[model samples]
Target: MRKIAASLAVLVATTTPASAQNAVDWFGVDGLEFASPATSFRFTDLDLRDPHVFLPITIAPFPTICFDFTDNAIPTTTVSFNGNIQASYNSDSSPADGFLDASSLLWFRPLAQDGRVARVDNGGADCLAPAPTSGCAPSATAVATAYAYASFAAGTCLSSLPGTQGSPAYAPAIASPAGSCFVTAPKTFVFDNNGTPLTLIDAQIAASFNGVPATALSNGLLRGFLRESDANQIVISDPALPGGSVTLAGPAGRRQRQLFHAQRQGHAPGRERLVVLFQLQRVPGDLHRPLSAFGDHVRFTEDTR
Candidate 1:
């Protein structure tokens, strides 16, 4: 009887499917919310049309930005590509700490291709003329790339607990560390000699989350602060003059804003939904020819499924 039992156990182990052993179930859909005011600078004689010819241009900040994770699953291990996920525990020290990680891509496009150049002249000669133009006729555009980083406590905020959403439960709050998750520093060279180069837009961004709830709640609320530094710059390559470039730098301006996220009720197991409201909170800074007032506000929703 013992030999028969051993044979049965061996058969069952061998017949188990590989997929069942490695199956991973992720929580809800991941998302993002972003917005900023309008700011800019100007450059003269870009095309060398005249000695003091000037053109006014505006900077392109993300007025509304979001990412969708509808087709992807939150991974249990570190992943790279369309999305990424990471988790770790600090076991060496007392009061062990846990972490949940996620990241997404950020991109900036020219506000308006046709409007990039406020105005241009050929120094009384057609710009397309073969070789008889009097002065330089300059044109410019901007581009940029960035990413968003967020980390949460795995054991506290993202843990699996039953009958906790309806109860008055609180989890440990998480805040952004003192390092930039998104940076466009040392300047990205757009429109270089390299084939298909991107335009560059320099922006200093600061973000944080406050009063975050540790656990899911039907009426959970959190405050978010997003600030764009005044020291923004734009770099454009001069196609007319090979190896030549133009840079637009401006003084400190303000575009401080608050974002709100409300937790959804009746969430499924391992899934949560959040609705975010985006709005401008403040606009205080110098307004010169290049810098304009803030634009419209935006809002959106995010889900974890």
Candidate 2:
């Protein structure tokens, strides 16, 4: 009788489930916003033939805007906006790469702007004319608000069991031979307040798993958001209502390679490159929704190149 009681007690203890921890809210009540630090302008002076001498041209600053929507208890997503205007003069025909040429003069202009909003003017004087005597009639052209929703294949928890010889783990683990966590859901997007979806041309997220224990991964993860230095891409898809999709493949779409390099130096030897292919589509009249619905596929592979 004593042995039977002991056995029953052990079975109950082993079968009792582990209470799940509260979901880590990377996004707070108010979503986050990322804007360009500053705007820059480049000017060049070209000595034209005789009368057409000392032509002044300006290159506008390239600005990047981003918004994150991790507040929802469901899927997570993000949106990004970026644009630039470049101009240059080719005197020697040696392939002008849009950089400041030694024989050319470059001028820089700084503009104070917000990433959450976009501003443009119509029906204005030609600022680029040979001689401009009046300022252009500036007006607000368009405005938009963007955000993202993401879901991990291994749920929100940071740890998972180690992978087998043929199939490795997708979520990070505490012990040796950690597994990787993939973004199971598509990175959804939403444009709010009668905003044009095309106002945002590109979006991406950079995640780093630097040997930090699973419990601590979500502590300060918000601060790890990617910035301008991560080499982002521009949207090339045709403009459509509600939303559209674009794919970033090959060298043009690569991101956060340096983080993988650092991990290779001393961290776990697990695969570093996690490829997440996103296909974005409009939610149709669901402007209130934080992000549109779409499908995503993830893969763990080596650098083929």
Candidate 3:
């Protein structure tokens, strides 16, 4: 149906793939462990990128690592590569099942310091360092070729359905940035329960994503909000992947952020939301908006289609 197609549309990009027989679904993860000593961690990822990652961390605001795996280039801060990533697919289950299944496990061998990926940045304050001489920053388009992938989607599940709940999720802080700036595109995501959208344009903040809180009057960074929605989840089952189940719970170790949808009679209440991404950035010109106190800095803007 169009609903399932729309939900699946959120996962548009395909990077680290399985095979022709299966459709590759992108996902994010945390709690990676080592296959060897404490210095080397290894697991498998049927990833959307080149089986690599940009961990959520910052060393003097230089957060990302740019070591080229193809050339075998190494950063002084990183160790030698002694890790592995192999895809083990089951005929009954696909990679998407393992990705969303709480018990199903897909892993990786971290190509970072001490054989570990960087820590999770749930608050989203971490800034990445400039690209090293050896390589460039891990980007969206380049994930198709170079490597390093994290999945984010913009979609809404039916509010009360047993399947297709909180999906197209902003899975934790496995996020990408525009250059050194954190990924600050607000409208890229839209979630709801077949409801309407609200508007909040020119929302402001401080220096960063977790900068000073957005007040009615003033703040630092400015943003544009497309929509805002309440949180809910449900067990999602896909007909394409029969015998498989998913929920798109983002990374938090054992503490999964559930996106469950409650069974309602008809429509949700007025206050209930249809949300989008929360972004932060600077604007060029100042506009005649009501919240003129800090629009030029880093505020928000929203529009509906």
Candidate 4:
């Protein structure tokens, strides 16, 4: 009788938990559901300042419709409002079963002609003419916007793994910047991961003010990087130049360049966390300007964080 009781106890301990409601239930809340949730992130974004203030070339460098003078000049650009962001989490007795969704709106304006820096008259300008005020206006601006979205998920299935090893992340619908600068209707970038990890594949910016394709921009004004690890840092590999890394910090810290790495470890049972850190390049005076070199432009290295 004693032996039987002990056996029964063991069976109950193992099966009872499985029989009860699953404690690992994780539900995915759609972006629509979070339309009103209080956003909880910092926006010390310098990109929002006057585009010329963060100039890669010189101070008060007049804005131009075309970047004919130097490569570091700020292009007249703007990004519209932020779009809906949604995140969902789920946990099953499986190897992979989680997802993340995020979306937003962004826009840009590139100067192609002179007088573009100065305010224009009531009459619009053309985008191509050296003084293109006639044919579409040389200082003319192009506007493009579209609903963009992304999704991510993880689960036990072969395709549930998180990373680029599986099907590539969904591509963003490309938009062309007008020959000048233009704004589009509010758009959103939606991210969904049905049941696998979603990886960002690419990002691009155009060189010309014309409404050229995104491929052309990839070679000119675009720079991007992949989320190496949750270390809160990532390396940007600009197709036009060499690759570099970025790190975020609390207050004042030496900016670490080139030398960096990310370390991460966690499981599906709880929230995932990542931190980034770096040592600043010790210099005499502040590195207000970057060293002279093709990829050495410090503007690119300016810590936006």
Best by lDDT: 3
Candidate 1 segments exceeding 4 Å error:
1-32, 38-140, 151-305
Model 4, poorest ten-residue lDDT window? 6-15
Candidate 2 lDDT over 144-232, as tens digits, reads 12222222323222222122111232222112111222111112222121122211112222121223222111111100111222223
lDDT of each candidate versus the true structure? 0.17, 0.18, 0.19, 0.17
The C-alpha RMSD in Å for every predicted model, in order, reads 28.4, 25.4, 23.3, 27.6
Candidate 2 versus truth, CA RMSD in Å, comes to: 25.4
What TM-scores do the predictions have? Answer: 0.15, 0.17, 0.18, 0.16
Whole-model lDDT, model 2: 0.18
Sort by lDDT, top down from the best: 3, 2, 1, 4
Residue-wise C-alpha lDDT for candidate 3, range 165-222, written one tens digit per residue: 1334323212221111111112232312123222323221111122222111111122
Worst ten in a row by lDDT for model 1: 6-15
Model 2 spans with C-alpha error above 4 angstroms: 1-84, 88-134, 142-233, 236-249, 255-305
Clashes within 3 Å, all models in order: 16, 15, 38, 45
Model 1 superposed RMSD (Cα): 28.4
**Model 2 TM:** 0.17
- Candidate 4, residues 213-285, lDDT tens digits: the string is 1211110121122232321232211122212211222110112111121111222321221111101111111
lDDT of 4: 0.17
- Best TM-score among the predictions, by candidate number: 3
Number of colliding residue pairs in model 2 = 15
